[model samples]
Target: MKHLSLSAQRFPRRATSAVAAAAVAFAFAGCANYSGISSDKQIAAPDKFEATQSVPGQGGQWPSLDWAKQFGDPQLPQLIDEALADNPSIAQAQARIAKASSYIDTSRSALYPKVNGSYSWTRELYSANALFPPPYGGTWYSENNALVSASWDLDLWGKNRARLNQAVSQEKAAEADMQQARVTLAASLARTYNQLALLYALRDVAQREIANRQDVGRITNGRVAAGLDTNVERRTAEGNVATSQTSLTELDGQIESVRYQLAALLGKGPDRGLQIAKPVIDPKVNVTLPDNIPADLISRRPDIIAARWQVEAATQNIKEAKAEFFPDINLTAAFGFDAFGWSKFLQSSSRQIQFGPAIHLPIFDAGALRAQLKGRYADFEGDVANYNQTLVSALNDVATNISAIRSLDKQMSDANRALTAATSAYQLAVIRYKAGLSPQLQVLNADDNRLANEQTVTNLRLKRTDLQIALIKSLGGGFDATSTNLAIDGSGQQQAANPTTNQTSPSQ
Candidate 1:
């Protein structure tokens, strides 16, 4: 805080004004030119993205904070809760928030006065040839000094305030980033869970296929014993059963692999996945899209919010850089005592006081200051581009998920009809084979078609569930950013406070 000697010297009023005027004139003469470095990027208007504009649905309060509950899976909410609480990513985000908060304190401190106290004592022998008097020459003496010093930057150019604002903006960005992390984590886990459900459904179908194959093998053996079928026919039927069993084995391994993935997503050991129950996803539980999606998306998506805050912080950084072009004034004062002996140190005669204004301005630094200002401008432009890109991508994600869901809905309907036909064909082939109207190969072929169709229907249904989760995530996973005033106009207004503190619902 004390950059210059605090001598107890006073300047005349007219002399101080003249010095200030000269410094001001020199500061402006040496100012950096930042005119050509302005950012041209603008935040992309939400309405300009056609895909988001045509999304249907209105007046629906979808994906509340407890969005996971809509899946009707009792275990899903608990797993997401565990991941949020125990995940390393979440912990890292929390630590960043703490660090950013501390910076706010550090920046805020500059707006106030700083005071320090110190004391020193040294015993030394005075040299005979030095300026010591005859009584003190060639003698040992103790020098004691104590002082209390204070300094405060007047901040007439608002440099410190701009710095403080920058810190605050960065903190808000960190907060939004943490929320984004949560949304990502929960969405990933849910999608993985949906995969687990799909695997279970497939496994069930495999088991049923195995059963059907075994029954066909039994009938073929009976026909061979009665001279109605050859040993080659029986062999074929047995091979079909073995093939189904192999499929079942593969499905089981896939199911376990998914369990492992789910466990990892839950931030737990592999054994934790073993304890996970089969997912019960209810496809009938519809996820309604919120109305005015693109208009409100800026506040809904945490990534967009965070990017916007980054731009806000960069604007403040430019302000701080510009402020550096002006003079910095600090009032410094020191009060202390100095004496050769401790006895005299406390005496009023030994007391000293000094106070003065210290002014600093950038007169010349080659091109370093200019380069730094230019860099700040460049950072602002980069942040603006980043914000614009994030907003565009967020809208694209929403639109992509919406369109995919609609396509999947139609696909699932077709798959269901196909599955029904396959089921009927398989039933008819079995009846015809038993009545001696069709060969055993016909029944096996029909059953294979039926199995494929069943797996297809199951997969499509579960995939639709996964997309529902994606849509919810694309909608910000119920994160309410309404209170986060993401102003990018560089007007230097304080951002609105978000009471959620950058945390999404752990249950989400």
Candidate 2:
């Protein structure tokens, strides 16, 4: 390798400057027009959510990273862990992260120089009819060449840097997506487990009702034999017992169905569901909100975080698109040896060296550059809108769940009172009939009312548990964005972590 220097005497400095000025003028004049196009979408204000007002569990405990454990269900946490570890969705999200990382590497590479080397040899016979010297006419000759080349895009307009930033943002989004998948899977599994718990509770109630109905049937039969009640009463009592039995059977089937759903959520076969023991959940789980209701939600929810990153990526894309309208300047250099014969290739006389600046700009591409810039702006606006929508929906999700949970708390209290009253009335009716003071019809009616109240209370409790899980999910399933590389500002803007200081600064 040899270094070649340029002499001002050979290439006058005055002429060089003239050429550079002309190049710059031409570059500017031919640059594509991209003015007056930009995104106008703004992030939704976090405080707009009205339901974030002070509620029952406001300022209480926020869901921990292991939110499933808070439910006091031993099997649920294990099931959620298995689902997160073994689910195909998790694997798919991991693959996306790997792919996004690769893109980052690819984009980052453009910021550096590239070098290549090549060697070639060929043998050919010259035609006699061609213009050639008599000695070489119609003769076979060998051609050999070896070359090394290097090029570096100066990126004076920051195009490549913008692209790199875009890739980084996409990678961050992928990471957030994976976390979102984990949150979704864990929450879904826990909710399904809660359903299984509710089914078991209902089944218990059904069994008790069946026994109660059978006692009524025996009482009716005794009354009919004594002519204290008509045959119609005895037949109706049999029908009541049959109805309760049918309900118990249906409850069993439903329990099996819910088990199957749990099996699927666990990413396992149906047989695995059969192995699951009954879920024992603490019924006193209460709804709680973190300190920063909607503000912290921006960073907590993975969907919102992912959407924000997408907006960041789109912003970078606009920068990149704008850069394309300017001159693309690069430094190119080559050192090589070329000769007609192999013997001369290694000689100093065969050496060749070249270096220069290469500049290119869009002269006329039929408005392609402008169109690309316009498309980039559109993409940015769309991403911004998407981010805003996601944030709004996330806040509302939390609000809705909290409201329902609070409402369910009130309903549960009323339901318990109704159940207690119905129980007392059913007992009184049974005692009166046994004492021959009331008809069998009255006892049957009271038993039906008691069963209905019992079912309502059981269903409401189940709903409360399900809502608690939903609320946890809505609160981001214990995700902590500050723990990750990305950070969120109070205004809900995304900030990048500074590699040197390991601190977050607002993204430009």
Candidate 3:
């Protein structure tokens, strides 16, 4: 068997040379070729904001990745783990990453060659009806034939590679996007669980009120039976008991609803509740903000980093597009088996192969290719805007959290003081009423005030915890912005764990 003879032919060689020269010139032109999105020049971050990879700040403690573990509550860590493992949004983001990665390979693959194989058989004869037969129409002869051929598109202008490059850029953006999704999911789960914990604490306060009011009812009934209390006094006691009990029922419903929400976030059914313990009542949260760019925040936020990567990817896309204005080169080569007849398919006489190259020339497409390049350039311009927006969003998150932390700290303290005062005032009022010195209204007012203050304290604590999670997420869940085109760490542990998890699943 003879080996396949492959030869490449370049057409319009002069025209191809001119296109190559144009590509180089166009690449330089694309350097500033603003297309769309309100052409803003590419510029570095403003001097005020510090880059993430800066040096350590005053105390020398960089942002901690163990941020979640800092919550002394043992249940928090477990909930976060489950959310990360099961959250459906995270799974969908992971799927996108996989899809983009495969597309990248598909585009890049064009840089190489493709191979194909085939088999066929044919026989012909003419019986007194052939115009070019040996006898010009008598009973003619018959013959069998078999042959094989192959062709390849020669990449004359690097067009195929340009498309491949475009795909590579897109894939890179997708990877960063996937990481951003993980951070958002984790933050969501942490915040939802915090809400549930606060509900549990509030329920405790409601139950206490119910018990105290029920005792008042029992004592008033005794006085009424002994003929020492009027019907009005007994009725008032009954009303107090009813109000407290009503409050307790509503609080219980709230707790159950929150628990169900938590279960859903963990990708589980309502019937199968989560095992997260009630949050330990902590008056204050210790969140340390990084002082300078080098400290951690600049680097840690995922959305900001992902946005920046998008800009870079867009820039590459522009480059790839500009490369398209010129001719493209492609190489297709194949080797396999072809047989006209199965009996002789593999035989020495029957074995055959042939190959050659073909080139593509873009004479004119009415500026279609140029417009495509311009579109990519325009998209890059938009990416720059998105990058700036992300940077601003990150800054806003930090600023908002700082204010929330301080406000909650003050609110929680005030609530505790109010609760203490209300309790003491209510006790004194009860004694005065029994000794016939003060009206019972005073006691009822104080009791309601104390419960309200207590519930307020729980809610404030939960809000502070949630704000902390928000701040952490805004920083991108501890991702490094400077690392790009570098090997992504993790098994794509960021990869979707369950294909169906995103199907109505909510994992972190």
lDDT tens per residue, model 1, 1-508: 1122222345666776776666566655654444444444455667766653547655778576789997899899989999998998988899998999999999999999999999999998998888987679889999999999999999876778878978888988988999999999999998998898888888888888888888888888888888888999899988888888898898899889989988888888999999999888887766777787777888889998898788778767766776766667788888899999788999999987877777676655676656887787678778877977898888788888888988989998899999999999999998888777899889988998898899989888888888889989989998887654443432332222111121111101
Q: Which residue runs of candidate 1 sit more than 4 Å off their true CA positions?
A: 1-37, 483-508
For candidate 1, what is the TM-score? 0.91
Which regions in candidate 3 have their CA more than 4 angstroms from the true location?
Answer: 1-40, 43-66, 126-131, 135-158, 218-229, 274-277, 281-283, 293-298, 330-357, 481-508
Clashes of each: 0, 0, 21
**Lowest summed lDDT window (length 10), candidate 1:** 499-508
Q: Quote the positional error of residue 4 for candidate 1 in Å.
A: 10
Over the stretch 1-508, how does candidate 3's per-residue lDDT look in tens digits?
A: 1111224333365664565556545433432222332233462354446534332233433344456776677677777678778778778878887897888888777665555445445443455644665563454333334443444445444445545655665676677777777676667777777777777777777778778787666666766777667789789988877877787788778777877887877778886454556766343556565556422453566665566556655654554554454443344444434444356656766444433333334544666766776676567667777866766666666666767777788888888899789878888877776665665566777777877777787688778878877766665565665564523223211111111111111111
Worst 10 residues of 2 by lDDT: 498-507
Error of 3 at 149 (Å): 6.1
> What lDDT score belongs to each candidate, Candidate 1 first?
0.79, 0.81, 0.60
Q: What lDDT score goes with residue 263 in model 2? A: 88
Inter-residue clash pairs, candidate 1 = none
